[model samples]
Structures are given as structure tokens and as C-alpha cells.
Target chain A: MNSRSWFRLKQNAPKLSMLAYMVLFFIFLLGPILIVVAISFTETEYVAFPPKGFSLRWYERFFEYDAFVDSFIVSVELAIATAVLGVGLGVPAALAVTRGHVPFANTIMTFLLSPLSMPLIVMGFALLFYLSALGFGVSFLSLLIAHTVISLPYVVRTVAGVYRGISPDFEESAAVLGANRLQIFWNITLPMIKPGIFAGMLFAMLISIDNLPISFFFGSADTNTLPVVMLSYLEHQFDPSIAAASCIQLIVAVIGLFIVERIYGLDAMTPAS
Target chain B: MILKRSGITTVSAGVVSPWWIAFTGLFLVVFFVLPIVNNLLNTTELATLAKQRPISFYYHKLFTDPYYIRIVFDTVALSVGVTVICIIIGYPVAMFLVRHSGKWSGFIIFLLIAPLLTSIIMRTFGWRVLFARRGLVNDFLIWADILEKPFMFLNSASSAVVGLVHVLVPFMVLSIASVLRSIDLQLEESARILGASRVKTFLKVTFPLSLDGIGTGFIIVFLLANGSFVTLLLLGGGDLKTLPLLIYQQFTISRDFQFAAAMSNVLLAIAVGCLYLQLRLIRRKGVKGS
Candidate 1:
């Protein structure tokens, strides 16, 4: 190599190695999921890596299983309800704290977002006994309440983050034009924070659907979520069907993420630092 | 009420109706605050219902019992181990993501986040597939002549740790990258112009500045790892019994809600302590930034 080329190669060496490390890191991050996907196509009764032959039998089995199918429907319904409730409760509170000039806004915001830091298992355990004591028992209502509490933070944080960014001048101008408080919110504020509300709702749904620890406490014949069902299934059986179920859940997640990426951008979805 | 400020007549001042705050606060107080209070109350009620000793009995057993003590030690150790691993492996990637990932930043962020969006159970299932006796890891090891027979990687403490690090490294990376992105590159350039080597500049200036990010990442990973039970339950094979795992058993098998409540309170204390430190760090950072 020429001396100039040699100097260039030395300059690029660290970058190239870092690139190499990044590739390895991606593989580590993604390898297991890929393996799960691969095994979902396995013809074997057991989960095989090379996956003896490419077949969709496990997928068929997943659909054919009543418990899996039922729980999946329950999870979807629960997630939808959670998203709605979380937004309803979270957005207005975020608005109150951010724009209402509430006293101790910082402390109130921290309290609202505190659920994000709490251990899910502890929260689930507490809710289980607490709700039972309140005569709610282990039912879907209790489950929804538990899910809403955990997901409320995402809705509040994202909406508050976005709302804080928006200049209050839009609302001020709207108010000056003789618009009422509701009109100012509806015509001026709501449209601006729609993306934040959308993102937060999606997060709430995603968190509710993917939750395991919380769902574990509330699982019954009627209330078992897909994750709860899948856990029980895995404990008793090790089969490729579980892989199929996992891949299906993964597909749902990807679709949700894809929508967020197309609209809000994934980079912007990072919780406020 | 109309408020006039800075020669402007503002009728509403954009103040949200107090009803919004009231409704949300009521919901939280009933559903969130009460449950925790109820959990605390359960600890006391166990003395009456189960004919057990007072609430102190459970706490005493947790701290005094050798088995419980060992589990507590293991839980903290596991959390510490996971946090250290995440930082060691995650910092470089965070640096690359912040400083070097120009065109690929979007795709890289997607890749980082996609795993997080996926259910923890699904991710753990992926590890299960890989660590199976006849799985890829065993196959690769045997094929590479690293062993004569397939070694069981499943259902062990080491496996649990590996699973956790894989699940949590993204959080660490994201936390550090967010902070790293905020750090001015000119500072590093100035250090270089001052005749400091690249390594010296990073160690002296960049590393010191990034401590807040590391601290944030540390607390987050530690808290998450500390609460994590699904990964342990799925991969731990009943060998590694952390408080969460024990609590899980209490609810599922033993039906000891009282003891479980007590254990979770301990877990809650640790999580709350970590969160307090994290909030303080963030507030301090915010103060410095402003």
C-alpha cells in the first residue's frame, strides 16, 4: 500500500473496529429473537435452532389452542381499554400541571410519573390484595385498574413533555380572540399535542399488552392474558408453539413501533431525560 | 378570573379547570395510593388472621432467616452484576450512537427500541430457544470443539444474568447516549488542542462529564434488574431465588400473601431508595443545566 493509503487506514482503524463491535452488539441484541422466529417455523415438536424443516405447524397449533386464542383476545381488549383510560386520566392531569400554573408542579409531575419507577411485581402484589379487600376480587375490572395505574405515567410524561414545549402564545391569542377555555383547548392546544397523546396512548397499549408481572397476579380462567397463558403453557410444556405465540406478539410490537416511527419518530419517543 | 401581566389582558391564562386535577388525583389516590397502603395494612392484619406474630415477625424472619438472608444477598448481587455488565458493554455503543451514527442513527434507534417494545416474556423465550440442550449455543459449542458434549446453559444463575444484561443493555445505552448527545464536542476538541491524547481527553473530560448518565443508567438498570422476576422465573430453574421470585412462589404455590407482602415491602424500600437517588441526580443535573 502507498504511504498515503497506510495513513488513511490507520485513521479509519478505530472507526472500523467500532463498526465491527456494533455489528456484534446488534447480533447479540437481535440473535435470540431471530432464533425464536426461526423456531416458530420448525417442523419439530420441540424448539430446534436449525429448525429441522420449515413448517408453520406451530403457528397452526397456536391458533388451534383455545387458551392461547382466548387469552390473546382478552389481552387486546385489555390493552385498548388501558390506552383509553390512561389517556383520559393522564392528559388532563398533564394539562393541569403544565398549563394551569399549579402549585408544586414539579412535585405533582414526579408523583404522577412515580409509577414508572415502582417495581411491577410489588405493584401487582399490592393491587391484588388491596383490590380483593375492596371486594373487587380477581376479575377483569381489577386487572384494568392495575394496568391503568402502571401505564398512566407514560401518558402523563409524553403529553407533559410535548405540552411543555408548545408556546402558550397560541392559547393566549385564541383567548384574546374571545374563545372560551374549552374552545382554546379544542381549537388551539389539542391539535398541537395530538402527536404526544397518540404516542402516549400507543405506549400505554404496548405496556398493557406486554406486561407479565402485573398480569400474573390477576390471571384467572377469564382474565388470563396472552403472556400469563404463555407462561403457564411454558412451565408445563416446552414446544415450538410457544415460539409461534412469541413471534405473533413480536409482530404486534413491530407494527405498533412501525406506526410510531412513521409518525412521531422513534428517537423522539425516548422518555424525557 | 382575569389576570393582567406585562400589559396583556389574559382572560383565562390557559388555566386548566381544577376538575382535571381532581379527577386524576382521586383516581390515583384510590387505585394507586390506597393499594400500597392496603399492602402495608395487610402486613399487620396477618397477625390476626393467620395467628402469626405481629408485622415485625415477617420482617424479622426476612432479615434473620439464613435462607431469606441469602436470597436478599443474591438479589442485590445479581442487580449489581447486571448493572456493571450493562455499563461495560453499553458505554461504547452509546458513544458510537451519539458521535458516529450519522445516517444510521434512525435505524440504530429502532433496533435499540424494538427489543424493548417486545414483551419480556417473548425475549426470555428467545433465550430459552437459544439455551436449550439441543439449542444453537450447545450446537455451536460442540461444533467448535469447545466441549465433547453439550453443556446445559439453561436454568442457571449465569444464564439468568446473561438474559438480564441482554434485556437491560439497551436502557443503559439509551440513557448514556441521551446524556452523551448533550455533551459539547468542542470540549473534547479543546482538550485535544491542549495536547491531551484522545484516551487522556476521554478519561479526563468526557468520562467525568458522562458520570451523570452513568449514574442514571446505573440506578435504572439496578432498579429494573432488582424488580425483574419473569426472566429469573423462566430461566432460573428455581435455583436462583430472588425476592421477586420468592414473592411469586408465595402467591402461586405457598399462598402466603402475608409473607409475600412483607417481602415486597422490602423490595419496595430498595426500589424507592434507588428512585430517590435517581430523582436527586436528575434534579441536580437540571439545576446545573438551567
Candidate 2:
């Protein structure tokens, strides 16, 4: 066969294999997501797949139930707190590492990312013991501290990547024009890194809210996040309500991830995925 | 010289040193040292917990016992089983995603990643529903007479592995896809031009180049599958107990914090050590190859 035919052979793959892969992945990833969405609309008595009938029952059940609503509110509050705390701890650290000219900068940065690489279960138990011994006793602040720890890496990495993208000349120019270090940062560096910071916050919030094992230890009945709440519901029985709660969180998570991925570009995220 | 010294002094005094130091200090304290300290605390608890009864018996059973060792082996076997399964299943999908271009590539990429957006709880909930006794999956199979009746999919260990593979296959696909993206398509084309058949060209040129991606993907999926709690906790359906879920159970339901901590510390150490070794080995190999 000529080279053209052989090239045709290579090109033939996309149409066939790509379509097959796309279908398989779509079903694999979104199949369950779609199931949850459908189950939320499910009018059945029990959690049913290819949900028997469509109604607003599950979603209605969620809002009508105060515990679920409280957990939802708690999740939102935790996510917001996590975002704020993470950015607070992360941005300065990111700036220092990226532009800090600190000795062993790379070594330090890797240490920051170590938490992300470590098993989260240990951290959760650690926080539980540490907070309990200190008399925090699974309180809101304790959860926030632990969540903030996990969230910090996202903020640091995102903003650091952003800082790397920007040339230092802009800051230097501001410095040359009579800006002090604080003014230079406020006027120039901060704004330049804002998108990264925003993306980082979004990522951090998702990590905080979606967290399972850690939340299990830190969450109390009143303080429970949605995942923790859902876990309790699941441990009890198979019902559409837990699925409803999951659907709600899943929608929010998708939107949150989309916004972050749009701003930061999933490609920009350390290639860790 | 004075101006330069002032600039340097100002940087060290006001901005640079403090930033790095603060970040390094915070990162070290929060992530690195604290978890290490915490894990050590868990490991130290094993002996202290020996007096606790059945849970304590469970610990001794796990440590000084035979059944516990078998469970540990089973856990590793399941993770490896699914890890290998995922690589087999995911590589073709990733390869195909890289082959498509233009609007198609954009569309395919979205489809591939969109599932990842959904909450794990939601995804697992969906899986549980479908795999339930009379759920859609069983309905289809039963209607088609693929099974005499709805065979148990939700409660079985095989089902648990399948659920995990479903959740984790995306990680593998994306990892391989990223590697494939970096692969020069021209090499495959050149191989074709040199008269290697399509199969031969792929086996010789494309597959070898994609090894790093596969390795990355395998490492990630294996680690995740190993450390996974929810998928096992929910889908394992009381039949399976992996290290993470077992750790959680020991601390919560059993109230054996010390033994839980020991097991968790061991698991964490194993995970981190394996990851570090994998990366170092890969880096060394990469350096040698280059």
C-alpha cells in the first residue's frame, strides 16, 4: 500500500475508536450523574434507576426536610469559609515561593504539595485527635482548620502558576515609579494573580465541601456538611432523598468546577490529573 | 551600588524572605510535619489498644493474626486487580480521544471529563440504584435472559471492584490522554510510511511512547483505589473492608483510636513511600533514557 493508504489507516481510528471511546466514557462518567439527576426527579418509593416516573418529589423532599437543608447550608458555609481561609493562607505563601527568591524554593513548594499527595485519612484522624485534645471537640472551627489545610495547596498552586505566567517587569515598573512593596503588590501583583486566586478559591471550596473521611470525623449533627449528612442517610437505608441531596451537590460542584476550569484552564493545574 | 543595595535590602527585609519563609513554614507545619506527627501517634497506639476486647481482638487479629493478613492481601489484590483492569479498559479510550481533532477533540474532551464533575456520592448513588436487585441493569439482563434473575451486583466484591473501576477509569484515560497529547503524531505517520502495518506501527511507535502516561495513570489509579473509602464503604456493602474504611470504623464504630491510628499510619506510610519511590524510579529512568 502507498503512504496515503497507510495514512488513511491511521486517520481511520478517530472515527471508529474515538466514537467508541466517547460513548464508553460518556456512559461511565455521566451515566451515574444522569442517574442521580433522574433519581432526584424520581416519583418512586425507593431509589430506582431508569427512574420509574418523573416528579419533583425528591427535590421537594430535600427542601421540606430541615436536617438536609441545614446540612446544605452548612456545606455552603464551610465551602465559603474554606475558600477565604485557604486564600488567606495560600496567596502570601504562593507569592513568597514564586517571587520570594527564597533558597530551596522548589523544595519548599514540593513540601506544600505533600499534603495533596498524602493519604487524607491520616490527616482527618490527626485533626480529630489534635482538636479533641485541645478541647475543640469536632467544633466548626476545628473542621475549618482541617479543611483550610487541604485547601491551601490548591490556592498556592493556582496563584503560583499565575504568578509564574506574569512577567516581573510590571511589578518592577511600579516599584520604579515610587510604589513601596505593599503598594506594588496591592496595585500590580495582586490584580495579576486575581484570576488564579479566584480559580484557586473555587478549587479549594470544592475540595472542602466534597471531602468525605475528614468531614466524617469533624462533622456533628448541627455542623454536618452535605456529604456527611448523605453518609448518615445512606447508612440508614436506600432512598431517593440521599440521591436528591447528592444531585443538588453534584450540580453545584459541576458549576463550580466549570467556572474554575474555565478561568485557570484544567491544563494549567500542575498536570497532576 | 547604594541604590542596588537598598533594593536588595528592601527585598529581603520587606517582601521576598518573609514570603518564602512564611510559606515554607506554613506548608511544613500544616501538611508535612503535622501529618507525620499524627501518623506516628497512631502507630504508637497499637500496643496501648491491646486491652480493648473484640475491636482490640480485631487489631491483634489484624496484626498478630492470620485473618487480618489475609484481608490486607485481599485489599491489595482488589486494588491491583482493578488497577490492571482499568489500564486495559482505559488505554484504548485515551488513545482514541487523542486521535480525534478540532470540534471533535473539544467535544470528546468535554465528554471524558464531565463525569468527573459530578459528586462521588451522586455517582455512586446512581451506580447503586442501577445495580440494585430489580434496577435497570438487572432489568435489561433479565429481559434479555442474560441472567435467570437479577444476580447480585451491588453487594458482591466483584461489583465493588467494578464500581471503583468505573469511578477511577477516568483518571487513567486522562493521564494517558495527556501523554498521548505530547506524543508526536508524526512518528506514527513516519512508521506507517516506512511500511509498518497499522497494528505494527501502533505497537512499535505509539504504544511505547505512551508508556509514561500509562505509568502515571496506573500509579494514580492504584493509589486512589487503594486509599479509597466511600466507594468501598458504600459499594463494598458490608462484605469488603479496605484499609481506609477499616481505619474509619476502628476510630468511630469500634472506638479503638489507637489501633485505628496504627493501621492508618501504616497505610499512609505505605502510600507515600510507594509514590515517592515510583516517582524517583521514573525520574531516574527518564534521565537515563534521555
Best model number under DockQ: 1
Error of 1 at A234 (Å): 0.4
Q: Compared with the real two-chain complex, what DockQ does model 1 have?
A: 0.63
TM-score of 2: 0.90
Model 1 chain B poorest 10 in a row by lDDT: B1-10
| B1-290 per-residue lDDT for model 1 (tens digits) | 34434324444444466557778888999999888877877743444666465667889999999999999999999999999999999999999999999998988988899888777777888898788787778888999999789777888987899899999999899989998998998999999999999999999999999998899889889989999998899987777999999999998998877888899999999999988997899799889989
Q: Give the Å shift of residue A82 in candidate 2.
A: 0.6
Question: In candidate 2, what are the lDDT values of residues A97-146, reduced to their tens digit?
Answer: 88877778777777676677667787788777766655777788888888
Span of 10 residues, lowest total lDDT, candidate 2 chain A: A264-273
Q: What are the per-residue Cα lDDT tens digits for candidate 1 across A155-218?
A: 9988888999998878887776667788878988899999989988898989999999999999
Q: Model 2, range B1-290, lDDT digits (tens) per residue? A: 78866765564443433554574475458544765685574433434545644344445767776767766777678878998998898887787777755557756666666666566777778788778887788898989998997788886786788789988887888888888888888898899999999899989999998888888777778877877778887887758877787887887688777667767766777678767866685666569679
Chain B vs. true chain B: TM-score per candidate: 0.92, 0.84
Model 1's CAPRI class is medium
**Candidate 2 positional error at B139, Å:** 2.4
Worst 10 residues of 2 chain B by lDDT: B41-50
